[model samples]
Target: MPEQFGILTMGDAMITLNPATTGPLRFVANFERKVGGAELNFAIGCARLDLRSKWISRLGKDEFGRVIYNFAKGEGVDMTDVAYVEGHPTSLNIKEIREDGSGKTFYYRYHSPVLTMEPEDITEEMFKDIHIVHLTGVFMAIDRKNLDIVHRVLSIAKEKGILVSFDPNIRLKLWSIEDARAAYHDVFPYVDILLTGRDEIKSIIGTDDDKELADFAQRYSISQLVIKDGGEGSALYIDGQWVRKEAFSVTPVDTVGAGDGFDAGYLYSYLHEFEPAKRLEFANAVGALVTTVSGDNEGLPLLEEVLSFVNQEEVVER
Candidate 1:
């Protein structure tokens, strides 16, 4: 009825690395090449729930790019819109894991092919079958041209009566705090749903309390605002109604992609008309489960697995 629950996500994909052992920093590293991008992760997460998801970005005509392309296609994501540039290379990010399960990331993404993306790459016809257009703040850090492209895409989606979901996946390393503030402010008015973390709100809006953050979002006329606080769970505000949901108790082996997983889970449930409280619970459970594995998408549970866990109280929704 809704065009097969189509989701269009925009972001860059990269490879990740992790340490092999749990003892020292000098140990040999266990290398794994996985597709990692906040928006892309959300798209794949939607695909896992049987949604028709498409990822839009520019990739290099190289081996790494091929790997990422094939991986997305294998995951059932629509890659027909992905542009392959001739001279640029794909982006990469290495995760250096410490013995105590902590990790650090180093990105090699400057001037990458994805950053060279232009508005011409996306056409108005692209929105013909899409239901929601998902965007992230990280893509805003790429360049003015790339940011312009995102703006164009969102603007087109809004005009076409498509829902717009914005995730402020803030990365301080990418741009200055001032730049982040200005960029987010410019795009805030166009976002229908705002998915963000408490820490990100404090950093972006300079607030810490749930009510204050919710009020701020309301001031912008956002239809739905979801604030995720890791471990403490999350809170949602929709149509002047508010609900809080706690996180599942799980020993996280790696916490890299948990937030993205949460975004995906919530969107998946929301599209299906699941109750807000249940959506929060399912989102938190999915985020927790992703941490139980090493890579980002590797640990994301399928719809059936999530339902089983929910049914058994192995993961509570409220």
Candidate 2:
């Protein structure tokens, strides 16, 4: 069976050091190896929701690469589109998890297999079965070559009439705010849905105010705009109307992948043709669930789990 959803992204498999005492990485001794990347994490979340999700990227032909491949595949994400290169290894990231739930991250992504992705890396065959193309701005800031690749993919998706979903998962270390703004100008025309955190919307477009965000979405011809407002909640704007929904509360173990989970939840609801307000609720639930676990993609819930969570049902295991 062909995958219904496709995600274009790069992997930054992480080695997370747990903080015994809240401090820097130097003091952290114990570490846990895990696969993490915005796109990959989102793909895992989609797959858990029973969306036939496929992740497209280049994987290094090494143990670290295999570690990521195996982990994602084990989570039910389709890895068939991933290319394995013999010479370059996959990228690695070092993350520090503090006791207070605050964390720091460092990336070793230079010259990694996914970072070197070319336009030719994507093919028509990859999109034949995909109904939606999920993208993030993090890949756009990698370099000009990557930015071009994103445009090419967008063109192909448009040609095929596939829906394009974008999350401006901004990484300041990857590019300057100016570069991010320019990149969005180039890609916004192709986006059908724009999922952004409130702070990220501010950083990318210099605004967190509702009117300004709505104006930007209108100018870009974005059909749906969703803003995540951390603990306060989320709001969805469509048809020039704003629908707000409150967030689900949870004691977070690690908050790294919450946004990606939210994206997954939103997309899952989108595929089901749910109402805008209901979609935001589901998205918030998925985002909250992800924070309950340690790794980025670990706590992503299945459809039933999400339903159970939404209904506030207690689980009595046999």
lDDT for each residue of candidate 2 in 170-194, tens digit (9 for 90 to 100): 8889888888888888999999999
Query: Could you give candidate 1's per-residue lDDT for residues 257-302 as a string of tens digits?
Result: 7888888888888888889999899898888888888677877778
Top candidate by lDDT = 1
- Per-prediction TM-score: 0.92, 0.92
lDDT accuracy of residue 236 in candidate 1: 91
Question: Relative to the unseen true structure, what is the C-alpha lDDT of residue 264 in candidate 2, on a scale of 0 to 100?
Answer: 89
The window of 10 residues in a row where model 1 has the poorest summed lDDT is 17-26
lDDT of each: 0.82, 0.81
Runs of candidate 2 with Cα error greater than 4 angstroms are 1-23, 97-102, 315-318
